[model samples]
Target: MSSNPASTPPPPNRTSGDRDATQPQETAEREINPERDHRCESRRGGTVIIEGGTVVTVDDSGTEFGEGHVVVEGDRIVAVGPGSAPAQQGPVRRIDASGCLVTPGLINTHHHLYQWATRGYAADATLFGWLTELYPVWAGIDEEITHAAASAGLARMALSGCTTAADHHYVFPRGGGDVFGAVVAAAERIGVRLHAVRGSMDRGRSHGGLPPDSVVEDLDAALAGTQEAIDRFHDPNPGAQVRVAVGPCSPFSVSTDLMRQAAELARRNGVRLHTHLAETTDEEEQCRAEYGRTPVEYADDLGWLGPDVWLAHTIHLSEEGIARLGETGTGAAHCPTSNGRLGAGIAPVRPLLDAGAPVGLGVDGVASNEAGGLGEEMHQALLTARARYGPEALSVRDALRLATRGGARCLGRDDELGSLEHGKLADIAVWRLGGIDHTGIADPVAALVLGRLPKLERLLRGGSVVVDDGRLMPVSEAELTHELDRASARIRTREVSA
Candidate 1:
């Protein structure tokens, strides 16, 4: 853990496709509006206005405002109208969005934030090979290392215009410090909304599972920890920053009994359930070998398919499985980048969506998806769907939908978040389309997904500006980088080398 800068060089901080390290960090703590009235305590902070932008409201009607403004009072958006409209009757802080495309903040439905330290370790490996290589290293993670990696991941996501992310941290190695708490702490400090799933793996290689025994926990321990996380952090309030879910890794790595019990526990607590399913043909084979059923069928029998449950990387599903998922209102977290990276086939996203299933975008884990941002994932989703199916299969708007509204539905937060609408939580992202990557794009909203990703000009969560001018407001990039380097070094030296 040397403080020497050369010992661990800082990674590039790219806001978009371009590399610009010269952006000012001056607005890290700048108030939205200093002169605004604060007499109304309910407004929390006074009104802040985003003026002169093309607003892309991913609402039910696909509303788009040509030149509009969004007025925020406290944590909710009070008004959205033409930019020419006069400001409301109150002291306000105005953000000039003249050359911006303002859209609802992107949401990430699945992630493994702790994998930030081990991003490229398995770059050339397949899913199972990659997991085998990294399990030992990940098992050695302590609380401090987990915090560092999670903080870095959240900050990186925030810079890319992500306001909320659902993380699946399933590895709980013996003696590894508070894995769940570390993720929650990092998200809170980075000012991103978090859905922290207490993921578990009960069946190990000793029991014919994919994961090593060292990283697996007993069912009782997993159940107890899941409830403890919910009791301590699952907030049901509107605009809540943190919520907890129970996720027992995957069908290949968890016991059938654990899976059934986890679902029961999640339903009893009224919390959500998440896990990986049908990511690979090998997974399907394993499920068939063990349970005499497909992954989807096994999950369904265990009561894992429902509105309260969302599965990640459902790539190898059958038509029957697809119909069952859609019928049960189950959601899917589509990880296009990770799937492509690991040589996993393109997920049937188009068919899944067409089947009346909720589909959302996920970066998966940084291990498989080095780009690890919803901005990049959205573009990847577009390309992968088109690469397999025709270009007509998915639109830029469709990708944007998966990143915003679709993600909200997967996380069961559609009523409170996900769109640019009145009374919705003011989680917004402003993209500067004036950059080199976005030039000559007729539609800024379409440019966001079709063109090279635009720079994230600003990001707001709960009506508060947390990322301004493509820089994170809540955490220091330099400090996060330093800690991440230290943690990564520790894992490489102490664990990877072992």
Candidate 2:
């Protein structure tokens, strides 16, 4: 990567009184006029000028502006520079981001939105044990339950500053009534971009798999459902609100035939492939016992290693597996918090980045990682990497990049959604760092990644405000909470009756 002209070295720490001296002239000039600003009003197809903030682009050159501005025209970023935006001709919505950090909206590379209703169960269980305990409960989910759970999950993600999320929904119970479509509907309702991976599991205990037979699909049914999802929701166009991917759940729960066929199906439709791989030693042992090879080698044999593929967890990869993934341009979703919760070993994030593999952070699932917020993943990833490797294994900027650019690479949306650059979608996040939690932090990026996750001031998705001033704009939190409670109770009731 080349050097960025706007980039600046980390500033010296200062008292709250001295912080104002660091502001640029343009930033100091702008003041909030509630009547004129209309801070969080809808911005569809309009010009939005956000100035007076620390701008971290996370672009190829690692651009950082001490105090800068971003101009959004309609759904795309029109300009980004070191000072206030140039004058605009028509009526414009001006945001006085005087004490905020502006950057590209965070992307979540992996999640299980449907698991939101299943949190707090199997809290002390290992990966396999947790799956065993939850499979029966998940077998009762219908389209209504899935919609409620996914809506609550996505609302939490938006509150945490994520603009785009990739949800891997694999559990399809009998007579679920379009459970996959419910996930898509929840994304639309929440107003965030969705990479809905139509995941399938075909192997059951009868076939030596982890999940029960009731939760598994037949081979033909799984393929047909995946194809239907793609035909209904996959959008190849840029700035798409929803896209579909093919995912056969995991090596332990999905048959060999399903895995190979799913990969072929994804490639045929020009969509991406995702799955769980090398997440635990148990999974590695199971793969070796069944296929006489490591997880990565088995995937390689099935043509699952490529740029269009990203595997989740990836905590137990061998050095050779890591090298192969890098050489093949495969992506990895590093879920640091979830790994630590399940006692899974730390993922080789630094090694993966060094070997040219794209690595992004993930909040694996609320079931294991109860918090399920994407912002804190950066902090967890940094500490875990340094604790396992060395202090220099990851940096604050590197962690931020993992959430933004690296995630885009994993989801194959690097061209449109990652960085704050011209011609890119206006999916931006403004975090308020002037509060007590982040007031004294000198470097804004460090304040964001190293300190507690700052309160989100505003989150724009495709130039529309989804979260404003730490509140969700599209739906009520109380409503989602109520619906989630009902969904959890319904699933639990079905389990009890069975």
Candidate 3:
């Protein structure tokens, strides 16, 4: 969208089947300096050893080490075991993690990063009312606003232990000036993996949808835009920093043709599909009234349920819907705080998990949830499950799994991410548990989930420090705050003028 090379998407190296062929070439070894600023350092081929912490692997075996060590070589985990790492050959930067808890970096399965500029609006509105109040304001967003909002949102996510985030941005107003590219650039600037869903909405209020007509694209344009996004930015390589997915907003705001065609396009390009599904009772009622079928049933008819598809919210599903999702191996992204904030009913999380569906946690959008932190989602998810179902509905470990391995499955990245196993990408989080909030907790994992969200001692994405000593390394938070403030003010002014 932009002629600037820095903003342009990288050409895809290989097809999905040839992921192994795109392995990063080794870089020349350099002296390891622990005290140097990590933001300015070259990350490739660097070795980092983290010892003297409780390592929760979240692997298939559910491995946990009371006092463990993790060795990172380049961008992959070389070894993970109890106690200190063995002898290393190169200059390695060792982090003494005596009072920390090491775990797989949290993965956010669903979000609308652009909404960061539109928070604190429609604070007490229902799902439909909120859309009614905010769609016009969202229509005022341009590339600058979107970029600022996405940067601030991703910065919050990184500081809170999220390494990979899926951002579903569907609102593309006329002359928005490359808002989607802005999101991708923000992810790059923030140094986190992004599943950028090029979302579209073809059903406007005129077509019995919730959003305004100004924000909805025609069916042809929507499909063309999605295709262009895939051609421009979709990366199929292993350990990809950015991947494109097809999303057509929600059923209530999308035409049936767009829904069917988006699914087909995703499959044809070997990419994934994402969308808001059964998020509220209003959505269910609308689907039933329009198609004489429940939301889940309607989706199945459109071929929207599969392993490559992950739906957001999923709060209004019935038993049969849950069974269908599991039978089809579909994934669900549970946004507990957002649901509670909007008075959307609690999702049937335990039932969905028991039915064999892959369940992950989502921060949704800050406009709805306000906090916009991935780590807090784990805590909210655990509390919501126990409050809705029973005390045994979910455990602290289960909550961690939902944020890590389960999220990896939802994104179809289980083989490459979501765990601290050998050969896996070194996306890890170290939480400082020595603080007052976590000092008395007997179990580090419990303190992480059941207690307060611990401060991140360090967050590494692909062996690069994203956060160190509870501070984001790549960019200044104050700069992001100022950018966000200006962006929000501009959007507000435009909305008022319009």
Candidate 4:
């Protein structure tokens, strides 16, 4: 959209970071001026324009260096491409992104937001062992900790250049909290697009499953909660801000009956499905003994193989399993760092991608990864795939696509958030091309993937700034530390009994 520059506000690029940690909610919203919040404008006011950036629209035409900007008359991208993109010489706020590489905000396919508080505890544990150890810790969650953890995770992800994400929260301790719609509130406050999966586990140790019985849900309650979460937060509009997915934690933690029913319920409501599958060799053996088939075949038998399903960590898939994934349109959420740390095998990413299955990168959970940075997962996805095969087997661009479009598709949000194209949400991440890692690099996108992590200069959700100048512009560091410190002290004390 064109602007006269005189009436509109100049770039609010000033570093509001020290305010991020303490005023987490307000800062995350970037509501410095309440009367003029862009989101409010979308709901009640008018339009805003993002002008002049090197737009990297990851469309079928590949990357395009459209020198012009984008126009968001409301919440949608009204125009793109230099001269052809719409220009509204109207009253608007102009963000001049001259020397930045603008791509769709990174779509995090899978995440565990509350687990941010439980990272170091599960460092040396495997998939089953890891859950056995931290399941109790998660069992302690309350509304306070859940809110803190969700805000903290979203802030961290936003700072790391993620604009939209899917969080899979499965722990439901007796007195834990009302996970019901807390994730939705957090996303609204943070101003990022979110898909919060109502993750569940029904069979516990008493029933021969992995999790403690205390953390497992009654099968009926589990199914009811899944439907409730969808009814309350699963938006299906074009530019939806929130959605829900039905996730039955894993093969070992849930009963096969719950798995089959969860699939049926999700289909009934038209929501997507997610679950952890084939993450490690131990998992494979466990499933074989209990379910009588490999993870892929087992899920297929349960009607969980389709475009609506995305399984985490297909690290042990065989050749036939990979082909089945491709043919069925099922997706995989690859978590390289979590796999390596847990001693789980490297996922057969090369074979999966070659077969044309949808693949997206995930950070898994903070407890397993110990790091939640957005770009970090993309880098790991690239490295792990190449390590398993040759360089030609996977390129940096392939990994990047997994983080963006593939993630959107996995979360069933591909129509909106994945790419920087017209009629999509105005969520974009802009990184500089002049960092130490790219002082003399030639190609911009290559400078990002091959070189050191490009500095996250700015991150926008729906054309609103959340991170500016390598830090969260709204929250303060001191506040985040205080919340983290308080949480840490409690966690340390509880771990003794937990």
Candidate 5:
């Protein structure tokens, strides 16, 4: 595979290791302004100019600009270069990015947003054990609670600098309302780009699946619902806020027939496919015992390996499996924190990248990870790679790339969402590195990945600010917190009674 070119040149006559002296040194607070209606069609994403920062463009060319500017006209970035951007012909909202590290907004390749209310339930369990302990609790979720959970989780990711996220929600109880619709509403309310995967588990214990009978769906019903979701919500337009995908829960939790049908449906509708795969040794053993083939082989047999498909975890792959994934152009979503939390072995991220497979970062579900921030996942990915493959296996920029471009590739949206470049959507994040926590840091980019995550001062999706001054814009943080707390209490009350 070819390496990305150095798009932005370093300081003139400076050595490679020299600190970029032109980086801003102080952060000035901005006064609160009245909330603007970001959803206005007339706005069409109004013009914005972000100037005076070190821009890290995780583009095909690894661009880094010391003292640069980005000009956003409407929803797309029009220019990026050193010094001030050329003035637009009309009115523009100017953002003072002084003392900030500007980059494309982080992308999350996999998540179970509805699990937000069930965090910490299986704190000491492995992958299978954790799912077993929490499946019953999740079976009680209704539409209202699911919306609350989705809103809370999406808001957390937005505040942490994520602009686009793919959520895999597989648990569906009878009369539980439209779980997919709930998350879609939540994403819209928060103004973050969403890739909603219509996930299903059609095989219960009687059918040898991991989930109980209560939460599983019929195969035909699952396929129909998936197609309906695609027809109803999947948007193919560039810079769209909501798109849909098809996801079967996992090898252990769904049937081979369901997997094939989900893949077929996704292809039929021109959407992507996603699932959990090879996350644990137990899963590998289950695939071997049930199908007489490894998970990758089994998936290949079912026509499930390709560019349009991305699997979560992927911690237990063999060399052959890795090669097949790369050859087939399949994607992998590496959830470092959740794997560590469940005692799952580290994923072969370096090997996956080296093999040319599309690899990205995922926080997984809140129940397994207990946290949903991409910044935390970036830190964990760095530490885990070092522990398993030596200190130099993963660089700070590499981890950040996984969280940004790698994730966009996994979701098949790299064309517009991953990087801060001309003709790309204006999904950007401005993180303040001038705080005391970031003191003495020479390289702001390295500090963002290796040091404690500094404050995320501003976040924009399509040139509209979703988080400003570290506060969520569309919904009230206090209200979201209270709603999630109430939903959690409701679930606990039902669990205690059951």
Candidate 6:
């Protein structure tokens, strides 16, 4: 097979995570490298053939699997074919995937992982009302609370097969906690490939935004903080485990001048940009009232429309807006779970895809969805798309692609993290398909996407196991539960005070 890339990220260096998992073309003593082999502690030569499952390869042609086997030599997928035997003379680690489906690791295009603590607080309210209720709780946050929340949220995503995620966390309560940096640290420790968008909001209630006074930043302070975070944590490598993007809150919550300034900073610093756009009617109303333009037009005017930018919950886009997004190559993160829970209108996903706009799936903030699992988001995405179109319009295959390839495109990281091809990073998830929901189904991918909240079997990033048997491998479940409870108790008392 040719080694030409199907979809690649723009020029930056590829990092360690993008290590080619394929076997080399030699009987070869020349293959040994101290840095890659000795320092990394990675195994070589042995093959891991996942046989017995239908492979859901979301490639250019679409889902095509006929009783295939994926040969993993080292950490990357070397060859995928019809249950082929390992041609080389080495021990093969075989996995029974006969009834299961082999898919790329799911990707979360946008999230606020720290918002897990805010769940169930304003369950029945609209977006703005809900934000108003939860912002104070968020404003009073410390590093301990925010880190725990981020860690817990990432652990949940890992257990659900999300190998990669982008988080847009815009809250900055003044305690020198560095919420954005802490989130990056949490994701790294948990072994999830993360793009931490250094998010900021400069407009408080005094500035006609919904957020409280304590959490908002000054415009210059926001830009400086973002720059510092990016310089410290953002890796411009292909296989980088951690990357930083700039997120200047949303249309209503930040000034237009700040938005443009943030975009310029991102381009100058060589990173990406993200934000919340057209999520609800209130946002649309604000854009119309304040900017005298639709949300899309306003974003375009602020220099926020481009391939490097991805907006969350673009559910309220007009026809002209859709065309503009298509023309500009901007991306959208379709948060089906949040949309359904909040009664936000279903996004026109069909039209967006048809128009050549990049659209990916996000679980959104747990406060809105009550849970953040990539697999659950996949289920929600397909269900929501089927609701908007016919059941057949958005297939289980398409939904999976949105979580993997589609998301990579949104983050402008398609070259490195999206697929299970030869050169792509060995970021993967394995699901054990053995229960009532998966039993009668012949296709495991179908069962996975359609099943009623099935557990994620395992998750691997950079060929390292982060989640094993439905639990985070590094941390104890009991300890996690205890910390979660303790954190909840403290936050509960604080909420009562507020």
Give the alpha carbon lDDT tens digit for every residue of 137-245 in model 5: 8889989999999999999999888999999988888888988899999999988999999999988989987788999999999998898898899899887899999
Candidate 4 lDDT, 1-498, residue by residue in tens: 011122222122112221112211111222224335333332322455444446667665554553555666566677766522343454555444554566788987888987767768866777778888888777777666676667777877887788888889888878767854666777776678888889999988899887778889999999998988998888887777788899998888888889999999999999899999888888789878877899899999999899999988898998999999999888999888888888998998878877778888888788888778777887787787778787665665666677888887777777787787878887878776664666565455655667677767667777666766666655655676577667666766776786
TM-score of each: 0.91, 0.94, 0.93, 0.88, 0.93, 0.88
What 10-residue stretch in candidate 3 is worst by lDDT? 14-23
Give the Å shift of residue 176 in candidate 5: 0.9
lDDT of 1: 0.83
Report the C-alpha displacement of residue 118, candidate 3, in angstroms.
0.7
Question: Model 1 over residues 196-219: C-alpha lDDT tens digits?
Answer: 999999988899877778889888
For candidate 3, write residues 1-498 as lDDT tens digits. 001122222222111132121113332222334586665543656678877778889888777777778999889999999866776765667766666789999999999999999999999999999999999999999999999999999999999899999999999999899999999999999999999999999989898888999999999999999999999898999889999999999998999999999999999999999999999888888899999999999999999999999999999998999999999999999999999999998999899998999999999989998889999988899899999999878877889999998899999999989999999999999988755786666777778888888888889999998988788888889999999999999999999999
RMSD of each: 9.0, 3.4, 9.7, 8.0, 4.4, 7.5
Model 3: per-residue Cα lDDT at residue 248 = 98
Query: Candidate 5: what lDDT?
Result: 0.84
User: lDDT of each model, Cα atoms only?
Assistant: 0.83, 0.88, 0.88, 0.74, 0.84, 0.76
The positional error of residue 396 in candidate 5, measured at the CA in angstroms, is 0.8
Q: Sort the candidates on lDDT, descending order.
A: 2, 3, 5, 1, 6, 4
TM-score of 6: 0.88
Query: Which scores higher on TM-score, 5 or 6?
Result: 5
Better of 3 and 5 by lDDT: 3
lDDT of 6 by residue, 272-297 (tens): 98999998898888788887998999
Indicate the worst ten consecutive residues by lDDT in candidate 4. 18-27
Q: Name the candidate, 2 or 4, with the larger TM-score value.
A: 2
